[model samples]
Structures are given as C-alpha cells and as structure tokens.
Target: MSQFDAQILVAAFELSYNDWTLGLRKSNMQVDVLLQNEVLRRGSSILEQTASSLSILPAENADIEGSNLSLRYDDGALLILGEMSYFDLEGLFVDTDSFYLTTGYRFGQWLPHITYARLNSTDDDIRRAPRIETIKNNLPAGSADQIAVATVQSLAPILWNQESTSYAIGVNYFFSPQVVGKLEAKMVTDRNGTISQFQNANTSGASAPVIPDDNRILIYGLSVDVVF
Candidate 1:
C-alpha cells in the first residue's frame, strides 16, 4: 500500500472584548476559537493496526477544537498570549491536548519574546503503531541479520504515556512597518521520549534501551518576514 495522504480545513471566529488605555499605557484583549477537520486517504492501514506498528499515527478522520487569547499593552511594546488545543480521534480511541503561553516586551523597534508549550497524549497504544509497515518495506535487502533484528524490534509496541515541554526565546527587529527579522533559540524536553518501538539489547529481562527515552534538544533559527 502507498503512504497515506490527508486533507485539512480550518475555520475560526475572533472577538475583541476590551481595548482600553490607562494613563500612558494601552491595553487590549482579543480571543479566537478555531475548528479543524481532516480526512486521510488510506488511513486505516496506519491507524487501525495492532500494537504491532512502531509509530503513533493520527486517525483517518479527526477533529480539533482550539482557542487563544492575546493581551497587548503599549501598542505592541508588551504582549501576552495563551492558547489551548484539543483533539478528538474517537475512531482510534485517542485524545490529545496542547497548551502555549507567550510574553513579549519591546524596546523601540526591537522585541524580545519568551514562550512555553506542552503536549499531552492519552491512550499510549494508539500513540505507537503507525509506521511499522513503512519501515519494513524500506529496509535493505542484502542485510538479512540486520533486517531480521529490525523487524523484531519494530514488532514490539511501546507505551505512549509521554509529555513534552518546549521553551523558546527570540529577538525580533522591525526593519519597517512591512518587514521584520528574527533570531530564536529553542529547547525541547521530553519525558518518556520513545517515539518508535525497538527491542532491548539485553534479553535478560531488562527494558529496551532507555537512552532515547528522555531527551533535551537545542535549536537555533533565524528568519525574515515580509508582509506584501
């Protein structure tokens, strides 16, 4: 079978509840609600598999509800934002949620921002079984021992009771009203970081290699944005 494909659509509603100024500072709050629906082609092959698959895949048809709020002070000089998103994949008996919070401070045309994000998934079994077929088909043909071990490693399913936290700090400079440049550094910390299933190196009743279970990753990025 071929790899799956997905089509997604999103709609949103927004409202500004308050916009006021006290003394020299300006403050406003706005909220938005979003709905997302997606359809997957050949989704069952990946989503309905037994604990035998090695990846956690999304269901063929899924729905997500999300909302976000933003509060601004002194025009864009200082701002705070919060967002929450929830997913319901009843077909696969899975549920997931995520949260994001951000705050920014501006000094003239230069802005510094900090953000935190977290993701939580329920139903670990549904989280770990979608990629076995792809891996099996992609393995090289000449290495028999390697392929055998790889197949066995992928056949075992791992639990998906995992949570991840990400932290980011960035500086943005507004070159003009229509253009901005940014540089950012981010780190992600994952608890129970196993995203793929693999067998243990020690068959003496020890667990699979725990080295990859918890991970901390650092990333740095630079980008420019232009509004036309």
Candidate 2:
C-alpha cells in the first residue's frame, strides 16, 4: 500500500537500505535518511520466451530505519515477489532484501529475462543502555548510589530486519520454458538501545557493555525454466 512509512513503532530505531535491477547494466541513485541505521541490496535473472520476443529488466532499491530486519515483497508492481522476516531491538540481528525486473517474449519453446541488484548488512548492537536497581545495604552501606543494585541494561527492545539484491550482465544460460530453476541471495544486520523507566525513584544495576556480532550473510542460487 504505502512505499515509505514516517514512523515505524511496532519496530523502532530502524535502519534503511537499497538495491539494483537485474537486466539494468547502468548505475543509479536514491535519496532517504534514517536516524539510527541503513542498508542496501541487489540481484538479477534471465529468461527467453520466443525468437522474436524477449524481456530484459534491471532494478534498484533503498531502505530506511533499518536497525533490524526489513522484508517487503511486491508482485510485479513493487519489483518484488514474496518474503518472510524477523527483527529485534535487544540483540544481534539477521536480515535481508531484494528487487527483480522482468521482460519476456514468446519465441516457440524459449523465454528469457535479464536482472540486476546489490546487497549489504553488518554488525549491530542489541542493548543500548545499562541499568542497575538500588536496594538497602544489608552487608555494608556504601554510597547512596551503590547500596543494592539490579541490572536492567537490556531494557531496550531488540529490533531486527534484512537487505539483499542481485544482477546479470550479458552471458547467461537456461533450459525448459516452464519451470527451469531460480537464483537468490540476501544479507542481515541490526542495532541496539536501552529504554529505562524508574520504578521507586529507583536505581539500576551496572550493565556490561554489549558488543554486536557480524551477521552479514551471502546468498547464491540457481534457477530453472519450464514451458507448458
């Protein structure tokens, strides 16, 4: 329905990204700004329908507020097909995205296509702030701030999303006009933060500094064709 959303609540502190077309052999540009994170992806494919009729298409994309995983699939209209995803604002994340452009022609037992795209996602933080709850000193009363403490650093919600893409230049090969095969690849990343609300004019526990792990995955695939 809507291309871009102003504020993504159910998911906060997000990152955005972009991708390219399959048949597109040229470069392109995109404009978008996010507060926390960003991501980019690309991909491509080819198919032949007939001797005289052929289809070639190249595409690209951009994502915003991509702190976590972002999965969007559009059928023909939005340059996507189908997708599934999971995101978190509290821990490391794995995500991905993609776009495909197709042009096909009928040529007796042949159909072809050309596509292009790119992808990228990196290490992210799940916990943004550290916390400690204060308690009465039963052992030895220290400073007013160091009496009894409970850790609440992970109060921040974990956000998750993804980005991916692909592209094809010139030389290609395929068989069957119906269902031959398919190719695919995608990348994932995320960001972290802590949202704290005091309980009893309360205090919080000291949290260990969180270090994000690298989740940039590469996807490769093969495609098949069939004519019926």
Local accuracy of candidate 1 as per-residue lDDT tens digits, 153-178: 34322333446788999999999989
State which candidate has the highest lDDT: 1
Count of steric clashes across candidates, in order: 3, 109
Give the per-residue lDDT of model 2 (tens digit) for 171-210.
1234543455445443323222211111112233433333
Model 2: residues >4 Å from true position, as ranges? 1-90, 118-165, 169-228
The 10-residue segment of model 2 with minimum total lDDT is 38-47
Error of 2 at 3 (Å): 35
